[model samples]
Target: MSKQDGSNRLVSGPEVDDSTATILHVDLDAFFASASLLARPDLIGRPVVIGHDSSRSVVTAATYEARKYGVHSAMPMSRALRLCPNAVILEPDFSLYSRLSKQVMAILDDTSPEVERLGIDEAFVGIGGLRRLSGGANRIGAELRARIRRETGLVASVGAASTKYVAKLASSRAKPDGLLVVPADAVIDFLHPQPVSALWGVGPKQQERLARYGLHTIADVAHTSQERLSAWFGEATGRHLAALAWGRDPRTVEEREHEKSFGHSHTFSRDITDRSEQEGELLRLATGVGRRLRDAGVQARTVTLTVRFHDFRTITRSRTLPEATDVTRVIVEAAWSMLEQLGEMPPVRLLGVRASAVQDASDHGLLWDDTETWGSAERAMDAVHDRFGAATVVPASMLRRERKRDDTGPSGGD
Candidate 1:
């Protein structure tokens, strides 16, 4: 029984009261796959997979039908094909997905000002203040789902509850195209019977740990003392689990003014064995991350490097600088330093660069900038690229590498 296939679906009946359920979690159903299907109406209810049809690629999205056959997003395309041999495979249309995402977010923004977008496919919306202007939370969720479908020809599922945790859980339970409203008075009843895996922090490893202690359900964790939980999982994690098990979530939906991190990643068509080529790709990724930080007027204190080997083994290393910076050279150097520490690397399939611990560039103190000259040159290059378009100004090494890659035919990366 796949938990995510809506086999254990629960929903509120028409007579259910939702006056106290003020929070809503709305999720687009099969977002990428559905968006790709908008142009191919004949494949409406069939098993569909959205991704590049390459064994090297990963599945970006899959319809519920495909999911029922054990195909899912982030799974390897080869494995997904093995699971659902007849599934309709389509390339991902990111631009189309973005447009629909904006349309959906705009509808939520119109309904309430307290919409917190989690990603392109889901968001948390608070409707407590709109009870009078709009209807109850359940009604508002239904109307919003209706509006999304009517306006975009896409399906959305909603979960409405008094707490964000319960609201998110409700939405997941009401997957595909359903609305579930869990009243405040019934929060405990709705939560306790669920499996331990349903809890926010419980992944497969956590589930095994919980099961070793016979904590297989939310009720088991709720019944266990926080002190004992603390003794087992340490103070913070134990307390967190106890609180969540009892349906206690104090978090509220709030708008974020800025992102906490910036990142970029590139996947290779083949396992990259050349050390110079690997370094070049890392530089390219760092350049992208730095450009985004500069564009956002932010500086990062930490840089992270992520490497995935051809065998799918992944590792991450991070370093914190004494001062925040938005310079590509600094980011590249930091990332390279971390990569060098790993000794000789195996063939890599993916490389990623991430910048975190970000702050407004204006807030950074100007004591002694190490890359001042290089930073100035980069800023000038940024201006030229902005005027002429990207790649108009790139490192000489990158230029040579691009020509070399072109000579070898397309390697398929973004």
Candidate 2:
């Protein structure tokens, strides 16, 4: 993993090596709020919270001012308002954000041919090819930030490092609007001092457990033996953490034509109490995900269902299939089963379905039963929807409801 070998020598720069710092993680500054406030120049430098204040709206993004008062993304709006009442709230405009995201991505694409988009607001660009033209990786990163600000009128924080994992953390440490570069040799030093939560897979619960074991920092995990980590977190996660703690990530950036996970979510205007309605919505989302998976020519081995209650408490459950599939019956069946495990539900505020562990359709082999019936049926449905319209075909249960809705529509004269 050393960057220097004969002709491939790492040129040492300030806090980074120009030759080794090929991977860069670029993240937009307070993406949603910043993009929306572009039209409202007066709102700059104020505490801004983005997302609706409806029954179950969660905070999508918050400005630095809002963040000071404990407001953060995924926090309930009610909680955020309690924390910072003076914060200016802006309803999210996804279309505007999407446009801005594309503009930023276009800049990155021009900067580096190998760009891996992580989300709408973040991407990792491999800058190895730009060495000669851009002087070095450090200059390429600086220019990237300068160009984005010059072209888009938005600030972007960038992190330059040897590995994607460290690069992502470096970018996060340079929040709001800043840049940080970690050299190949200093990757361990860069990772060790950070909080345990800084590790890739450590969540709130895992953090609490690690703290209980007196493992509060990445250095703690690094010092701890692999056997101990395995005993604490089980085999796979233990080994994963052990490797990461030493600043080891073998993954490389690749252009993804599609995301590893694709799904849809809907927040209800009113909380739904009816079990039938909840199941119906879950079915709809699952079916939608299945269609997208098949359309993209990918089979998903896992289905995850997310349900948020009226009080903003959320529960997510996932089911891994024995065989990957792009069939609606398999997806809906898995989602519904997982949803059932949440136990007696309260008034549901939102529902979501996601499909992950994706593989190309050509690589997926169908069992005899699925091939003969469900898969064929779904393919036919896909053909129908493609030729006619999305609403032309739906689940048998939703048909009657659609008819009822049409009947309730206003007459042509009225």
Candidate 3:
């Protein structure tokens, strides 16, 4: 990789999104795999897998060549090996990955303070206020990529957009060390033709749900009635998805103060097909999530339920409550309600629970004693769990999976 690879030069390409973009989503090109290749340059363009060669070890990273053979991050190492039998399986070096991540982060820090890191590899950097001082967004993005190469021997791809959501899409479109600029007025033109699955919140299950309504494309979502979407995806999420379909994201790029959301999901060793069994798993997850929220001294306004079927199709639903609470009973009941929304259960692969829109737990005026009493009892249980172990205190109707996982686990917090 060099400064003169033409990635630093502006070219009229189809993948380019020429919106009045000031948000930069810069991601290192295969951070772990690329860093691994630095010492083994001979494997630069080869199928390299960065993970231990063990039965349960998962691929932490795989180079693009390995990806061509369908290997990817989080894939079981055994599967990756079977897919790319001749792949160079390298064990990960966390010390080296951390060092490079810090260097890359330092480079980002030099660019802007308003950088919201999504992971070690990618972040959303707001360059709107720095337009005058730093020759516009795309130029800054291109220069940043070049600077990373010159200083850290790394290549980066950047997506510049008016909002962080679109910016991320732009960056993915410009992969392997390239830049794509999605201008403001061009947002709709750039987004509408894309699949509805391209939207941030729409996953496999949601995709199938939307597909049932003939909403396959972003344009279809844009044209669909907000009321209809609300009826299907709940009021808040329905409107949110509609707005995204029209490229109407309004989120800002700011330094995070604390974690926004926390979640837990578990894949069953064997698929469970019974509805009652799935309910038991979801209830267990809700208890875990509620415990986490209370332990963090926070209350969550929204709860989400995720169900993955044997075929790998996932279904997720989110509900925002009128009031935020960290009570296990409330969370469990809400989660169960969401499961009921699925109509009937299919053979299940995984179940998960997540809480979001978190805020510090505070005593609002005129609060009831029951809420306070419940908090005290839960805190007592937390102490018991901490002293004895997570298995010491649990919901009376706990599943075997939950009870078995409690040993030596953290008292709470995801």
Candidate 4:
């Protein structure tokens, strides 16, 4: 946390040797909006907001220009419009964004095998073993930025440091497409004067509590005894904070781990009790989960459906499949069956679909000879869909509902 003027630069840890500290954090700039702008060059340099256009919708991403007018992702569209009336709001094209994210991840894969994808727009690549291959972290970061720009037409901010926290902070500091590096020797000098909020685990509530103890800055927290900090933050959080204050993190960049489950849920603008409508919503949720599983090259053996009643009480039910699958039809059927077990008419506020007991895609097997043949056919269809687009092919039921929805105009209640 090197202080310059009013800001603090992220510092490295003592365990990091000055000559060997090689960690990199990569963050795409205004990812969704930027990718949208790339597809539509006319929108470049303009204030772009990617999200639902409905008044009740929340923003998913806002360009830097939009940020100037106080527009930001996760903000209500109604408020964003009030803040920036002229801003161009676009519906989120998740399929396109997902495709582009795969492309970006592929680029990072070429750079380093030890890459941990944090989200669609960011990842950490360990270059500790690549010093001989790329000279140093600085050169590696520079090349990565250049490659991304040249290949994807997107700007990326990068931070190089010894620890994950420091690297992440450095990347945040190097926002709007920039790069920064923190050497090991400067860790304490760089971190001491910064606010405690600079530490990863220090959320607003924790910050307020620390402030009560006159521990506002990293220096203050660093000087405070670990026992005292633990008493305030509890054992785990306290220990974590103290270690971070000293610029200590032992996490490593590794392959993206397969999740135990894949799921998606939606909160309705208003609760409803129509069984047909609820079934339709469940199908959509199932489709979302299945798509994600296929995209990640994984399959789930158990399908779980969760129903949140209008009163907010939630119940979850799951069923194990005879065989793991990434097929949308298989998942949707399983979810529909689970929904049937919930009995009649209960107004629902939220519906969710979860696919758990995951396994590698290669682990999929056929239940019968005919099912094996269908599995090959399904794989072919998945390949075609992946190569073209999700909407290129879909279940007939989905197609009919989509057409009906389009005909009825946008879902008005948001």
Candidate 5:
């Protein structure tokens, strides 16, 4: 490909042609809720909510039927139940969901080499080369949806467009399992009538602010003067929003590296105040993060601890490790140390552990080095955990910590 100019503008030359780029955005329909229904077929056609089983717990995913009752992911589970009294509440099954996500990702990989995963349920696949294999973008989208359904027993919505932003918006319009294509000439037609919220990063506050200025739709934003918009929303956001309104995204689909951060968090059934109990929860979170890192062939150089109090106040503390490692004991110890340093303990509504600043296994030193030795031990332990089950091996410290925490009482403070 020829390089663009200094302004990042496409350079015109004898070799340059006005060819269209094909991008396909794939979104799994009601991912967590759908996966839950797949595991238990009886839940099909019913309103389902997947989240924690606590009054203060937030919903992670909800079926379309539940969404009709105003239940949505991130909403409090109690409010969701109040909205849809008959909705089936289910706990988030991260392990099962992660496994199913791997299967779906593998299927995408089978279709194209340039696949950019947005999350567990969404991805963008560059199909410039797929025309030879699957006929064209439209055909490839159809085949992809059909394949996902046939193999995984799930439905996916797809949108084909020249730009990623338009492709993503098209997918949203084609929800509950459908595919729509917005050709280069039809991008404006497909996007103009949509609400401002449809644009990426336009959150509740931005939408409300824009609405007051009579900018209710993408078309309105597109038609607004840049100078006026900048005065209202500031220069950077104004230009960014305007570009999105015009469907001018220049992003290309490319494979992303393994995640740089891996973490897991839990919302308690009740607010926890005990330090020992908090440590037990930290150990659990550490184990989850460690398993993920090992599975991805990565080691973390830093560990972070996050705490959210009952009032929704959140704080995070991180520490750099002397050497990169993925051992559960080491990660948990690091997290516990940060937690202890926080000083003022409050009733914690949520606890999380994260491993960040990840590096490849090869980055570890010689075989005799401490990091290399730890890496090997972790690999062996992971093998045992995979073959038998997660509970096959437990860190000795975690076991002792849990026992001590449990004896202190449910809140751990007494």
Candidate 6:
């Protein structure tokens, strides 16, 4: 874990060698929290948590000061308040965040054309061919941090390394506005001491699995033979881990035309047991997913449903459609079908709908379109939403009753 106070932050020295560390990972520090604080400069140095001021709301983002008390994104607001009672609470401004993100990405685009955006607040920039144009990797990283701060009033931490794996890890170690460059020669020295969880794909369950074998750190994993690791974890994951453990990443940064998937999730104020209510929530989520698909001018061939039980155990199921579609009803039916297949489920704490395998809507022409009417109606509704507001035309089922403890926030995955 990184120190929230920046006491343990690392950066490349003036005379450091960055010739081989051309891959840069740039990440904004506390993006939502920082953007929300732009108008309230008085809260600059104090602890602040960004989320709705509701007991059921979850923390969308937290400043470093709030993070020191163990507050983090996706955590329940009630728990966060208990952790930092005096912390200031602010609502998230997603539109403001989107504007700032565009400004930051524009700066990155100006710096290098080979930029791969990971999300609204992070990107991978390849600067191997721009040494003469932009100076050393260290200089490029430093300039990026400075430019982001000046333009967007947001702090960015940059990491430079020969591979994406090490570069991303370096950025986390230099959090809260700092930069660190790990040259090709010193990659192992910079990687081995970190905990196993630092490795990509190593989540809590995987970390526990590694702990059972006494593999507590990257060094332990690096020292283990490929065959042994493969025997413990299957073939593909084992080989992938072994390569990353030795600071070997064969992948290069490539610009993605669009995101892989679009999804919307909602955590209920209380565990929901009523079947009709659960289905209604799923319908709401599918409506959101379908709207996003149509907005992107794409259609999804697959729909996936995610369910989190009251005990926190989660599961997902997916089904492919006969025809690609961006219609709300089609998406809702597919998601509900998957949910029905789960049999008798436990009380659901959260539900999510995702649309994947997306492609240009115009390309997916059909001989006989079964959803022509539904699609037309949805597009008409979309027009109404654009003219008036999103709430102008919602499904009658959603208007049956107002949820007293309703708490909705933007999903980071979106």
User: In terms of TM-score, how similar is model 1 to the real structure?
Assistant: 0.75
Cα miss at 201, model 3 (Å)? 1.8
**122-237, model 3: which lDDT tens digit per residue?**
77888877878886776788889999899888788888888888888777667666788878888898789888977988877999998998899999999988999999889998
- lDDT, candidates in the order shown: 0.81, 0.75, 0.73, 0.75, 0.75, 0.83
Clashes of 6: 0
lDDT of 2: 0.75
Better of 1 and 2 by TM-score: 1
Q: What's each prediction's TM-score?
A: 0.75, 0.67, 0.60, 0.85, 0.85, 0.77
Per-residue CA lDDT of candidate 2, range 1-414, in tens? 000111211222354555788899998877777776887889998988777765356677777767778787777778889998998888665435544666888898888789998777788998877788776667877788899889888877788888999888877776657778887888887789888988997888999999999999999999999999999889998999999999899999998654587676767767778877778877877776777677566888898888889999998888899888888888888887887777688898778888899888788567747544887888899788767756778887765443111000000000
lDDT score, candidate 4, position 404:
14
Over 1-414, each residue of candidate 5 has an lDDT whose tens digit, in order, gives: 001011211111223121354898898878777877887898888888877656767777788778778787667778989999999987555655666677888899999999998766688999887776576666778889899999888888787788988877777776767777777876787679888988889988989999999999999999998888999999998889888988899888979756768888877777889888788788887877887777667888999888999999999999998888777778988998899889877799888888889988568653324655665677788778767766678766456542211100001000
Better of 3 and 5 by lDDT: 5
| Candidate 4 lDDT score at position 387 | 83
- Deviation from native of the Cα of residue 403 in model 4, angstroms: 9.3
Residue 250, model 5: Cα distance from true site in angstroms? 1.4
For candidate 1, the per-residue lDDT at 180 reads: 93
For candidate 2, what is the TM-score? 0.67
Candidate 5 pairs with clashing backbones: 274-411, 274-412, 274-413
For lDDT, candidate 1 versus 6, the one ahead is 6
TM-score of 4: 0.85
Instruction: Point out where model 4 deviates above 4 Å.
Output: 1-18, 257-260, 309-315, 368-389, 400-414
User: Backbone collision count in every prediction?
Assistant: 0, 0, 8, 3, 3, 0
